[model samples]
Target: MNANNIVDATTRSPARVDEVLDRFFSLSTTRAATLAPAYEALWKTLRSNTNGGKRFRPRMVMTAYEGLGGEDLAAAAHVGASFELLHTALIVHDDVIDRDFVRRGIPNVSGSYRDIAHTAGLSIPTAEHRGMSVAVIAGDLALTGAFRLMGLAETNSATRARLLNILDDAVFASAAGELIDVDFSLYSGVPSVEEIVDMERLKTAVYSFEAPLQAGAVLAGAPESVISALGKFGREIGIAYQIVDDLLGVFGDEHATGKTTIGDIREGKRTTLIAYASTRPEWSAISHLVGKSSLTPAEAQIVRTELEACGAKDFTERLAGEHADRAVAALADGNVPQRLVDELTPIVAAVLERVR
Candidate 1:
């Protein structure tokens, strides 16, 4: 298929995943209502949290499944939706860890609950605690909801088992990656570029890209060799995707990306961009500005200027392109089908499309 056809196909996959999620939420909402009104409110909040996502994980699953001529789209849909739920779970927990109250320019689950607590006349500290507690419970629900969706897949025993294994690996690797990421942020020493790259791969590549692609192949009953190839492709592109996202976090137009450009710099996120910048002389001038919760927009702008002049931005861009190239090379080396390859190659370009 051509690129347009591939885009159309992947676009349809989100609709399929949405169908599955709708059914799951419908049932959950009813059950929660039976439990208590507050329980029902949590489910409503969760359903809202899961909305407006890019649905990238589900698209990856469907891409591989359909590309390989998989017949069971229903099974694939359920599997794809599971990853989306997993994505939600991780981000919800991450917000709690970061103590971030906003997401996508609005109040997140924690923030919403905190606002509710405030309206209820709770003290600031108590409200904050309540928000965090509710958010933790909400994230747990999403995490378990992911596995529940997986179990709803229509596939037989053997295929279901394999898919579950892939999901398990994704979850395990992502949790480790998240822990290491938090550790890196807290540690005094600067992490190596290689280490950050590994962390990125583990945190995002496995679940967001690799597992979804691999699971789709398993659903299609693809050979082990092909599954391995797709996983590699997913890893390379996933890393590139994240690196570019880091770039966007610093330099891209917040209005265009719908994410804060200053948040990463303020949080002292140990990204590949920051890692490369730290080796430069300009870093000394701006190092103190980082991680300042009260960092002003003007100060953040200075940090951005230093990062650009120090060549960190250009170096990181080149690194992202190199990884994208490697992803293409994997397809060539692995003898992935021409149709599968053609569809997948465009995705590599799409990964870097934002920062450009």
Candidate 2:
């Protein structure tokens, strides 16, 4: 379970994961058709979205399981698929909340419905409603599918319960985090830097990284200490991932990320970057520019200039590095096998370097 071997294990999971997911979707297709023609159409788009994104979450589960010496890859793959489905469900709801029409360069769940409505010559307002409705239903469907998939994992009743409990906790935490995120944006004053980090952990860290690793560890019969240690490491790395994501939201090439560079600023999304910049006096002049749904390109550029001048960019980058260091140190402190350490190195790199 060295780094190379970890990579090898992960490399083999893609096809196996896809194979299981394909079956899952086929079942969905039949179920959706039974629901209605629109449901059938939604299932097709869900399948498309499933095929589009890289299955990193599930990979985390499988690698951790195999790294810990779990020989039952079939069961591991099922759990891995469950995590990916959970992600898919959440993202669909997320898009509805943000009114985001696209993800990874294509129409998101709501956006797909929006596109369909547009093709059918619906009015803008009607189309928007349709989009939101479809996305919500789609998200619910995916969430239920995720739960069912986890229930089917080839493990004992006790282990199955543990896995489901982990998934349930993660879903609860993620929902709370999303709610907090909305509330944070509505705060009268700028949130503290600590708030952003805390939100990052609750929102993105636990389920995306920690839950997957813990789920795998549990199935592999790893001790509670190992599971707890992996959880901490996931938290640190998850925070780093968010920091880099915030950076990319503002500065990375839209062509690469398939997101509008100005979206975060325009949406007035609260992030650590904003918290850091708010400490400076110059923030008052440009503060009004952010959060405007109709923000112009020139205004976005102006805001960007001020953010850079106030040193927020540099501060965010430095702080992200510190978090990455902490994550690595936590992994060491966990005293996990060297193989687990090696298995997780890319996750650390992805967060710190923002490559994947």
Clashes of each: 0, 0
| Candidate 2, residue 74: how far the Cα is off, in Å | 0.8
What are the lDDT scores of the predictions, listed in order? Answer: 0.87, 0.83
- Candidates in order, TM-scores: namely 0.95, 0.92
Q: Tell how far residue 171 is off in model 1, in angstroms.
A: 0.7
lDDT of 1 by residue, 251-302 (tens): 9877666668898888888999889988989989998987888999999999
Question: Which residue pairs in model 1 clash with each other?
Answer: none
Residue-level lDDT tens digits of model 2 in 1-356: 01222233354455677888999999889987988897788898888887845677887888778888899988988898899899999988988988888886678888888888988999888998899898898898889989999999999999999999999999999998898898887775788899888888888888887899899899999988888888887778777878888887887677656667898888887888898988898799788987888999899889889888999888899888888888888878876889888868766765655533
lDDT for residue 28 in candidate 1, whole number 0-100: 94
Instruction: Please list all clashing residue pairs in model 2, or write none if there are none.
Output: none
Report lDDT (Cα) of residue 339, candidate 1: 87
Task: Supply candidate 1's per-residue lDDT for 188.
Answer: 61
